[model samples]
Target: MEKRNQSAITEFLLLGFGDLHNFKILVFTLFLIVHIMALTANVLVIVLVGVTRSLHSPMYFFLSQLSLSELLFTSDIVPNMLWLILVGGGRVSVARCIAQFHILCIPSAAQCLLLAAMSFDRHIAICRPLHYATMMTVTRQLQVVTSCWLLGVILALFLYTFLRKLQFCDLNTIDHFYCDVAPLLQLSCSSTCTVELAVAMVTYPLLLSPFIFIIVTYICIIRTILKIPSSTGRHKAFSTCSSHLIIVCTYYGTLTFIYLFPPTDNSIELHKGLSVLYTLVTPLFNPLIYSLRNQEIRAAIFNYIQSFKKWKAEK
Candidate 1:
């Protein structure tokens, strides 16, 4: 009898919605436009925060950090994605897959934690206005920022370690646009029970804790709003929270659907589209949705333009 040989697989192909027949160019062009917008929006927020001295408070400080993280978050997915579509390529090396997974996971988990921290800031600012200054000092801000990223790093590593240990036998196609863990698990050769249970045990609390705090913060915020004698004051308070609420909902709603519910084929297809909204579109819109509509930001823009003109004339 001839000796039989078995070889270990070194890479996996990402099926990525499995190539639309003729929509490659159209999709690439559309994504390019969105990519440009995403970069521009995120960069604008970062730059504005850098140039403005008055925006040095905790809120803007966190916003700037969120903008930076969002920029990273989108960069990790969009470029490689556009290339895959444009070239009609879906192949990715095992090493590259793990690397991409790591980069995307870190910033995402960090932002989730950062958003939670921001909610706490809101709670302190609104609920205990007098103590807000002392509670959210620069030292506390640094501590919170450090804790957010460190905690994220620890949690993401826990998931990634198990995910990387998964053995792949035959399947390589990913149903979604990006390398998400659940869809990847469907391709694993290992008993995914351990991974699934570990994942849920770890991730459920990470997702829920922030949402719980956000709920509590908003409850307090609404109470404070109601206490205001003037209707205008109440409207303004509601408006202030509204933009953040829109962003939080858009981000978390799609994410919950992806992770909490089981991934049916239909839901997988739905998730691909919706993931674009949450991962790429929502982050870009955050600065715009929250700040562009604000009168203060509008006034700042006007003042910036005037200052630029005056400096040009003086020169």
Candidate 2:
């Protein structure tokens, strides 16, 4: 009965980059631009923090790690996706899809955890200003970051093992731009309840816990800001949080829209649009979000440009 009713999905057909034969290059160019922007911005953030002596603090250090993860996370999807849309066929083999899922999924979850850690750092600075340096010591930040990476890898392992057992029997076409959990699981002919339960066990905490942490941290931050009794003080505190809130809202809003609701017929178009934003747009926005007001990254880029100019003159 199991084999009779269930036909395994050998591969998945990803419907992405739209269907204009002539515009394929244009679409590829757009994605390529986003990719290059993401890579350069993220790598610059990492290098700026890593090489700069003044940036050897808890906040900048964590930001560097996040940059590294985002680099890996976006690279896994966008490059392969661009190849599929621009030149190669969009069909992904089962094995390849499985690998992509694990790689993409882990970092996605880890980003949420890392964001929560960042929020905590800010909360300490805002709420308990006197103890900020001591509380957010380098050792503590390292532990937080290390924990996020470990949890991400472990959750990915569980997802891979759990997904391996399920049999996919329905249509091969994936509606979203990328290989997402819910959409991929939709085609399963076998027991999805197991997959659902196991996944919830791993994912719900990663997503929701961070949300809760951010909320709590900000609540304290806001309270502390209120007690400051000075307009300039309040404004500076608010400005610090505004950037992170924007990023959190953008990332979590799109992610929740796709993952929270059931895949109703009306959601198909919305899902595709949101997937593009979450995957590509976030990569574009992360550096802008974290680095624009950041003097360290700006100085790092300036120094690099100066060196390159001098080297050219020497040559």
Candidate 3:
């Protein structure tokens, strides 16, 4: 019985939307549209940032990096999710499941650190405008972005390496849409107490530390904005910072609940719904938010469109 159980789960069957089996086609169509739109939006942002000389600032630079990360992040999940929804249920090899889990965590962890760094960038720009140029030099901006990616990859690997050692026996059906650390661990037959502890320890510093840092930075930003007697200046300052704040709140708020809390059998469905907010909705809306909120982004997009039209006319 023990050997049979051990051999039972060489692959995982993702039970996606079992409750909505009747609406699989609709679900697949909706997801497909979202996936395409997300890719197009992020790619447009990347191109605009790269080509537009006027957008060559620290804020836009960080935004472009974020767009790139969002591209990879959604790519890691949506394609597989689309397939599963269209095909009803599908099998994923054990190795592929592990890889998927790692890929999902990489961009997410990077976004956490990147948002923190962006907050710091805004803090210096708004609070210490005099020294912003010297303090956040282009070289330093590159270094900060590099560190976000490096730290995210290193820490995600640490969690993945630890998870890889754990033995999964018999239980292989993942209840959620995709492979995630919590759901995967829940499927493990062995007691995951030690691994969970290690994950929690890493998760706190990665997620909460940056979150608290952002909060503190925002406090300083708000204070600085208030000191400006001119209401117009205050509105301008608020506009610049508000987008990041909105993105941060939306991304981190859901993430905190998902990662910081222990997963329970009762909350699996709830967790899955919340995961959609951060994983799909956040990335989907990021480009839209920036494009709509930032005048500079809008101007660049407008110029790019006009240039494309001229080129087509000439062709």
Candidate 4:
């Protein structure tokens, strides 16, 4: 019976916003623009960090890694989402769905850890400025970035293994746009107690712990900035981390609301809307936030533009 049930289901019907028949074209156009903007913004950050000597510090290095992660995260989910919006959702093979989940989870997990690391970088820059150079050396930066990605890969694999074990009987209709954990678990015919437990174990440490660390670090940072005596010094110190703080709040806030407080049937649409914020909007906002708020990034961009114009004139 179990074998037959498992064999009977091989695909899922993703009913993505099928009810919004009139707004399909509008939604598709908006998502396409956002997707292109996100890709362009992240790629610009990556290229600037790689080629620009001014952005060689630990902070910018982490920002570049973040852009790279956002690139992967957005690329994995957005195109499919756009397609679903255009077609009013469609069928996706079980294997393809699981693969999408794997790809999405990896970068999502990595970004959580990476944000924590960025907070630490800010903490050191503000709270322990004298030791910043020594603490955040090139080798240490590499280690931190490598660990985030490696742990992310491990976590994704662990979840994938458990997900593979679940049987998906006759019911395979997922109302959501993507293969998120909650929707997938709801569809599974097999017992999901173990999977839920595993997810909780991973989520608490990966999500909550980092969030707590960021909060604690910011508290210390705030206290230190307050003691700087000069208003200029305080403002400068606060500015260094303000962008990171904003991103952290937005990212963790949505994630907490989504994962910590599971959505009810009535709130599923709201849940999907919030998912779009972090998945689509956040990536577009990241580079913009940094570019607008960080003086160094703006200066770098301006210098590059001038240099490009000069080269063109010479040619």
Best-matching candidate per lDDT: 4
| By lDDT: ranked, best first | 4, 3, 2, 1
Over 11-110, each residue of candidate 3 has an lDDT whose tens digit, in order, gives 8889865656678888788878888888999999998888889989899899999998999899998888788777777889878898898887788888
Scored against the true structure, residue 300 in model 3 reaches a CA lDDT of: 85
- Give stretches of model 3 more than 4 Å off: 1-8
lDDT of 2 by residue, 1-315 (tens): 133354566988887755759888888899889889999988888888888787787777878877888888888888777877875457887677778888998788888888888899889888888999888877888889999999999999999998877677656887655677786677766777888988889777777989998999999998899998889999988877787788889989987887777577787887777777878889879888877866666777788789999999999
Number of clashing pairs per prediction, in order: 0, 0, 0, 0
- State the lDDT of candidate 4 residue by residue for 130-224, as single tens digits: 99999999999999999999999999999899888877887889888888888878878788899999888888788888898989999999998
RMSD of each predicted structure: 3.3, 2.3, 2.0, 1.9
Which prediction has more favorable lDDT, 2 or 3?
3
Which residue runs of candidate 4 sit more than 4 Å off their true CA positions? 1-7
Output the better candidate (2/4) by lDDT.
Answer: 4
Question: How far off is model 4, as Cα RMSD?
Answer: 1.9
For TM-score, the strongest prediction is 4
Per-model TM-score on C-alpha atoms? 0.92, 0.91, 0.95, 0.96
Model 3 lDDT on a 0 to 1 scale: 0.86
